[model samples]
Target: MTLLVIGGSGFLGREVARQAGRSVTTHFRAGGPGRRLDVRDRAAVLRLVEELRPDVVVNTAYVQADWVTTAEGAMHVAAAAAATGARLVHVSTDLVFSGRDVTYDETSVPDPVTPYGAAKAAAETAIKGLVADAVVARTSLILGDGDSGHEKFVHALAAGTASGGLYTDTVRCPVHVTDLAAALLELAGSTYAGIAHVAGADALSRHELGMLIARRDGLDEAALPTARQGSGPLDVRLDGTRTQARLRTRLRGAREFLAR
Candidate 1:
């Protein structure tokens, strides 16, 4: 099957493309292994989708600070997927929640408290409206790979090269990029629809997660300073019990993966 992965240069998008078997990947500014197509341009997205007519389109592109790229850009991709009748697997975030609830499940409605969250939430809504059968997979902090931003931050913090403390109150279900990518690809071929939580099995604070990563990498765990969150959501935990039951990929916890 021909798969199209948007944001192929990104951490998760790169993994998605790598495991996609037969796939066409796209990048924005970064030099990608495949084509260069900005998701912000509706015509370009439509043109690529029309030309490829891929069986599946996994949109992993999003700019946290840009509304056009995060929200409107998603609309363009969704429209193209709709036009081509391709199965879509959209990557959403746990930030979509406001931490008003203790934990969020597939049935929970988005109540975002931040602009980034709002953008991601908006993108989720648009994709659902365009592709009725699409999988709106909401995930948490993606790690596991040492190359991921979070992992790199942990390494920098340990080396006393980075500023800022890991928030002790900021809770998240950090997932392995490999597991998340594998799960997303499996959902691409499955008939399951609607929002699905694809995250780690363990719920942890930012500081605690950093400690795990530090220990795994043989870094000075004590060097990683800790602090409380300043604003926004604090304890937004995504419960993936339902989605995990349906997937073949084992969504290992941070404690498990980092321990290795």
Candidate 2:
């Protein structure tokens, strides 16, 4: 199957490309094994999808603060996929939830607090409306290979190179990038459409997850500073029980994946 990975230069997108049989990737500026294309451009997106005619298109491109890139960009990709009749597996985020104390399932409504969350929530809505057969795989904090922002922050904090402590109150299901990517690819190959929670099996606070990373990397976990998040939702966790039963790939938790 020919797979076209939008944002192929990204952390998760790169993995999707690497694990696929035949894949053509697209990048904004990460400089990887794909052509440079911005998802924000509707015409360019349509042209590329039309030219490739990929069987599946996984869009992983997003800018937290940029609505054009996150929400509108998803719309552009969804529209392109609809136009070309390509199966789309758009990567979304659990941040779409407002961090209510309750666990959210695939059917939960989005009530984002932060701008980034709002943007991602918007993307999810756009995709659902545009593509009837698209899979909106909502994942959480993606960590892997010591290159993710979360892992890098842990390293910087341990080395005294970063400011601000990890948030103790804010919580999420941190999935390994490889696992999330594999789950996404699996969804791409399947006929399953609509919302699927593809996050880690465990829900942990920022500080707790940092401690795990620090411990795994032989750093002093206790030395990692911690702080409470000032505003917005806290302890928002995705309940992937239903989604897990449908998947073959196991979504390992932070404690399991980060254990030494």
**Alpha-carbon local distance difference test for all models:** 0.90, 0.88
Q: Residue 193 of candidate 2: its Cα lDDT?
A: 86
Deviating ranges (above 4 Å) for candidate 2: none
TM-score of each: 0.97, 0.96
Top candidate by TM-score = 1
lDDT score of residue 186 within candidate 2: 85
Cα error, candidate 1, residue 31 (Å): 1.7
RMSD (Å) of each candidate, 1 decimal = 1.1, 1.2
- Please give, for residues 111-170, the per-residue lDDT of candidate 1 as tens digits: 999999999999999988888999999999999569889989989988989999899989
lDDT of 1 at 229: 85
Model 2: lDDT equals 0.88
lDDT of 2 by residue, 1-260 (tens): 78888888888887888888455555553576568888888999999889989898899899888999999999999999999999999988888888764599999999998899999988888888889989999988999979999999999999999999999899899999889988998898898988999999999999999988988899987778999987887888999998999999999998999989
